[model samples]
Target: MTEPDPPPAGVAQALYDRRDGRLALEVVDAPAAELARPHRTNYFTAYWVRAGRGTFHADGTRHPFAAPCLLFLTPYQAARLDPDDHLHVTAVRFHANFLCVETHHHEVGCNGVLFNDPYGPPAVTLDESTEREVADLVARMRAELDTAGLAQAELLLSYLKILLVRATRLKRGQQGTAGGGVRLPPPLPELRELVERHYRRLHAPADYADLLHATPKALGRLVKQHLGKTLTELIRERVLNHAKWELLHTLKPVKEVAREVGFDDELYFSRLFRKATGMSPTGFRAFETDVRGGSNLSMPSARPSIPPPPPTGQNADRPASDPPEPGA
Candidate 1:
């Protein structure tokens, strides 16, 4: 596979703010044009494409998007825009310290639906009416960011919450229609919740089956049919996602990260990580740091011009060694 182009030389590292270290929010009316190239950011990003037609490449998948849609990207996800026509885009970026999606998931329900659902598209197509609603929210957010006042962050966050909630509803409605209005089985939804809660300790499909009061065979079949992935693959992907986040955003050692993710053997963890991400833990951290031109905590004055390493084998999003599900 071809490697992605590095950020242009002398490009400043993207940060929430250099003045107030505590503030972790930024609203860009027109972000850097180089975003059309493959690049990853250290913060959560939402691209409000007011007018555009393009293919959004994220984590090795190409999603075709059009005007008046919202594209969501999690931190450290590889992304690029290939516009078929001139694109007018506004970017909103925020660090996890500013607003933790998991903490606010109960209110907005965007933790999985908008930001981190591995099985779903990363872009939300908006109808004309919903587009107007989102555009109003973005305008208000921009206005709030420009002004300095008390509870500004709170107000901005409230607006963000509303935007997320609306997008989540739209995305769910679209998904329901696409799936012919077939709702997931009870066990499938429960399985997602169980995996999110217990993935660290419980690594097997049978473990989740026991918790959901279903046979592993049945649950695995359902997952494969609906989600196009095996149960083991789902668990491993979640584990690797956490591992990648820790690797990118924190200075934790690989051994510590491995143990935190329920692997007692650091070497085994490294092997699995390499199999899934095309880089060992240390290498992934070092390479991503170099690509971003600084550690997550520090800002770089200029980005270095260095090409990224190509994939070792298969796409990192799909591990080659994912075991087949029971009775597959």
Candidate 2:
């Protein structure tokens, strides 16, 4: 027989947050010996195990399933569900647009995609005490579902946040199946770390070279060689990225934006933003506010001048993109 259709999107749900978005709670009881290819759910989902057992094939490996084990499947992963016995599955699905509106929110890729680690799928198995917390959150969700009113969306968000945090803390998995995980490179991944830590400072090239204990010329040469851009380029990209985020998301003033990104002078920040983005912060925000408001956040008109590769962990905040290690 042909496989049945996957569950409908947003079934058993309603509009909330001024009808800005919706969420679904579903209970599935099934008995199927074998299954077809792994299923892909475009919307974000968190599946909690209430009863029965099954094995999940995800992130290129099989994760054994038992009752009370929670799985956090991120957007765009393929997973196969096969029940060893019958299956009782409780799931929550929410649209991304409600979380943050994107023009074409349903579009294939999630920008600002955080945590691309699949072998890094969050698996948290709840112990008895923690399971009660999970149960309480679910109960609240069930109660929220019963009432129909204006504030339900905000209340739902509150409960969902509680459940997600609790599940991540209690059940998010600590181990990946052997050999299914990606290897963090042998050398320390440093440049990205530097960017991550000091990007907020918006330090200049010379500052970084000093921190890395190398001459500015050597650092520039090494960075361009590995990362294909000069040190000046990396700092600007991060500063600009943060600038864009604040412009589009927060109503923070121009001066505050400069301060947050380490530009003492609002005028300098405006100049730098224009150089990188081809527009001032106000113009950038106006553009995004026009399209996505929460809809269309603008991208750098030019590609990152120096898109440094992940740094070697050895030199905590330096880029492997920089010159070879002295010992090496």
Candidate 3:
């Protein structure tokens, strides 16, 4: 079956179109009506809520939020903010190519901790001081955004890195053992990083076990003990997540999407997708478009628009010129 044309560019593009597809920042006292309904974006988002209260939805999970909080949304993660009218929010949205977390994971660990985390609340509750610090960083970013300096993009990237680092620290603190007691297993962080880096190519728990230098049995035990799921389950979740994103965002054929996610056999991939999501990939793609608006199917673009890679000259695993933290 032929796929339809992609949906219209979202509000972020409306805000950043003149910037030539790089980054956009805005302080929103009022969000559009569509934001209250579930929607996904093609860029990463960070929302700092300054006041009021509401429930923030991510991937069908509802997280309650109060004032002075930080919320994150990765690309293609379905999210909605049912926020009160008085809510004040500072929103930062950028394409993956603009500041690729996959490229700079070693420098700032926000990709796993803040954005693509499958285990934690997408919203981080902030203490007063941390909130103030992040607000200052956002303000600095806003300042750089307003001026057309030679290093404007670099300056904004620096501020963004610092903000991500600060949020990572806070998120780690929040996930620390309750009652200030038990130490988490040391392998957990590396495990998450490995999964994020290699999930596209490695779908088996044993593959991750070999990379970690641990026996498959031992690694599986650790994952189940800490994360409450078997290691295989975790790996599969990551693969399915990427597959779903491709289905929603790209016009790739089902076979191509399957292969992109490491499934060489399209039929097997379709079976797995059906088992996990209760629909075939084609059905899911059509359903996503239909719900977003009325069905007006059109021919796919000649060149399918896949998500952007890490910026040129940067290694996928690590960048050579990882920007320094703000005030560092």
Candidate 4:
């Protein structure tokens, strides 16, 4: 199918409570044109593509999706849609402060499964039953958003929680079914957890292997077999994710950001960042800021007329960068 034309340039602000700056939650029946362009949001977003056949691009992957699918995007994750025909979408957005996805990870299990799992697809295909349930939940959320009542925020949050929980459950079921109900090896899961905890300080796979009580070579082979990436690559990706978050969300110098991510040599860090993302640390910040019109609090009101430069080399084949945190 042919991709739709891009939208014109403009500013697009996300929904947020005017009285409370920290509380940002909105449910909108977004226009197709608004989504046809690459943009980033300060809040987490989920698009319920009610009726559409197109490619959904997020981070650096192109996810071709049809109707009755849910596409997820983390904060500052650049994304766009290209529909073959008319596209109907409803978007639900909420900042971390509004729902604290990490805090509710135990309840919904969406922190990595739905949002941040680098190895997983960014789009989830929903079955008929799951679609109906999600639609009902979204409708209730829309109704609550429109009403001005006591404890409205609490009620809306409950609905959002249910929606996330259901989606996570469906995704997990699909994963298990696809893998013939086989679970990952013990150390693989532990490696991810350890990377999340120590990516800033531990740059070597040997460090993780020691922590997991496995030989480095055995653990490395396991990672390559299951995740299709080297242990070193996994650790580097985690470190880069943190660096991206810091570069976009803070005014910290590139050197400081590099140091925070365990790199003492700023030049080496910049070289690594550029190779992975197709842009230097400084260049990335500048380009993204320009794209957002100097604010990461909202998506472009309109899509940029000029397309972003296509990534080159190794990055061209895989997701090269992580979803950055929103800028203050």
Per-prediction count of colliding residue pairs?
0, 21, 0, 5
Question: lDDT for each of the candidates?
Answer: 0.72, 0.54, 0.69, 0.72
**TM-score of model 4 vs. true structure:** 0.60
For model 3, what is the alpha-carbon lDDT of residue 53?
A: 80
lDDT of 2 by residue, 1-328 (tens): 1121223242221221212333433222222332324555433566677676766754334556677756555433455665677655666655443344133324322222211222132345666887788778777777777785778877876676666555544422433222223433311146556767887784777777777677889777755543334667656655665676678667788899899988889998897766444456676565435333243334332333235577666775775557876896
The sequence of per-residue lDDT tens digits that candidate 4 reaches over residues 204-302 is 989989999999999989776555467887787668767876776678889999999898999999988865554578866665544333343233334
Q: For candidate 1, report its TM-score.
A: 0.61
Reference-based lDDT, residue 104, model 1: 61
Model 3: per-residue Cα lDDT over 41-123, one tens digit each: 54578888888788786654556777788888876555678876567777778755456575568888887789767655566
Best by TM-score: 1
Off-target runs (Cα >4 Å) in candidate 1 are 1-23, 31-33, 176-236, 244-328
lDDT of 1: 0.72
Model 4 C-alpha lDDT versus the unseen true structure: 0.72
Better of 2 and 3 by TM-score: 3
Using Cα atoms with residue i matched to residue i, what is each candidate's TM-score against the true structure?
0.61, 0.43, 0.57, 0.60
Relative to the unseen true structure, what is the C-alpha lDDT of residue 163 in candidate 4, on a scale of 0 to 100? 92
126, model 2: CA deviation in Å?
1.3
State the displacement of the C-alpha of residue 317, model 3, in Å, after optimal TM-score superposition.
Answer: 34
